[model samples]
Target: MPEPLTIMAVHAHPDDEAIGTGGILARYADEGVRTILVTCTGGELGEIADPSMATPETLGEVRERELRRACTILDVAHLELLGYRDSGMAGAEANQDPRSFAAADLDSAAGRLVELVRRHRPRVLVTYDDDGFYGHPDHIKANRITVRAFASAGDSSAYPDQGLEPWAPDKLYYTAISRSAMATFAERLSAHGINPPMSNEDGDVPPFGTPDELVTTTIDVGSAVERKRQSLWAHATQMGSNVFFARLPPPLFNELFGRESFQLVESRVATSLPEDDLLAGLRGVPGGQRHSPAR
Candidate 1:
């Protein structure tokens, strides 16, 4: 029998999945796509944004449960963990930990992800860009491993000891936060007489978010916004009162979170530009039609 259509999203932490790719995850799952989330770390050093939720020692355990709840809310078909520790923000002490995702051996981490890719046999793969979105150490590391897995998973010679069938995904995408969207959010915040978090004093755009032209696909998740929001709330230990997401009114929040964007970094199949759906070229496609992996 033909394999099920699948999407595998690799992330650095529990909540990272919600903020970046929750829309796509929920939207695709609703459409009967098999959504697989591979989180690389246990989020061991995450701060307790909700002090009443979890203590430092139990944060990891709490986060695992939270992530499970989020997966359920998003209707994800599978949730996998790479079992590495969180390497706290760039340059933080946690980066030195041998168990942290940032300190993990490249081939080893990529091997772990590659195993999942082969097992899941996804049609699409997603992760952060080279800059790792906002440059967190674990995020940067996650990007590296994901890129490596995307390139190596299909090669029978790669990680041969695994004994799993080689499976190459048809496309690879980088989840992106658009600069235009951020700027517009800033404008909306200003018009509402509320100060935007982490905004520069002079109203310059924040350091994160991709330029509009760089974004290759924008998926409107208006129908799945509730699931995404619930997924966010599931990570209660990470969602404190000061969070901009929680502070916004319902309508504004819905409007801002209604769509998600991605950059198509690699594709083995032919596709047109300005895509509105992630499965544009893959739907009804024959496996024989996909191009072989190119080095």
Candidate 2:
């Protein structure tokens, strides 16, 4: 039998995996692809949304358990934690902590990810865009290191001391929320008399989503929507009952999140958009081909 296809998703915190990529992870895992999740931190600085779980001292441990439950719900084949502290929000004091993910050395952090890439030898890798989706410091740092690791993992000279042979991924994608999807969700929220989260007081859209024209791929995960919802609910301390995701009716939630979007940042194989499969043209290629890694 051929080796099973693999996909690695690098995320900034525990619950981020469920929020941003749970559908794709669940869908692909169900289709027999090996799904690996690399969480960059333990979410030590995350707010405890559950009133019962208000002990900050144990939040990291609590979140870790939540992450594990989420992985099971998503059927993730492997889970790795980079073991850094959460950096909190952009301008917060946690950003200054040397042990925080946002304050770690770029090359050093990338090196750790490179080791995972070499070991897993995934055909595709997923991570955040340059702005880190919403610009939280830890998210931005995760993007930097993931982008760097994508390139370095294929270069034999980059980290020879890591003791693994270089292995390049066939494709790299950035998780994206398309403007059209955002607009639809905003309209739905307004119809329900709830203030849309993406709109400002002036009614201008926030700098949160990618332009519709720039979205290269849209994966329809309608079949996996329930699994995705279950994964999200697993992070109880991070997502309370009043949050937008939890408040949405099941039908509406499926309508909004049933499809996921991605920007194909780097690809070794030729493929056209708007693509439905993240693997695209690389599925039948023996051992897959490597294009120049993203710089």
Q: Quick one: best lDDT, which candidate? A: 1
Cα lDDT of model 1 by residue, 1-295, tens digit: 6777899999999989987789899999989999999999989887688677889899999999999999999999999999999999888888999998988999999999999998888989899989998889888888899888888888888899999988888889999878877778788888987677667787565556888888999999999987888898898887777777777777777777889999999888889998999888988875422334556
TM-score for each model: 0.95, 0.94
- Which segments of model 2 are wrong by more than 4 Å? 201-204, 288-295
lDDT of 2 by residue, 104-216 (tens): 99999999999999998888899988999888988898889888887779888789999898888878999999878888878887777666665678655675688888789
lDDT of each: 0.87, 0.86
- Return the TM-score for candidate 2, rounded to 2 decimals: 0.94
CA RMSD of each candidate after superposition: 1.7, 2.0
Candidate 1 Cα outliers beyond 4 Å, as residue runs: 288-295
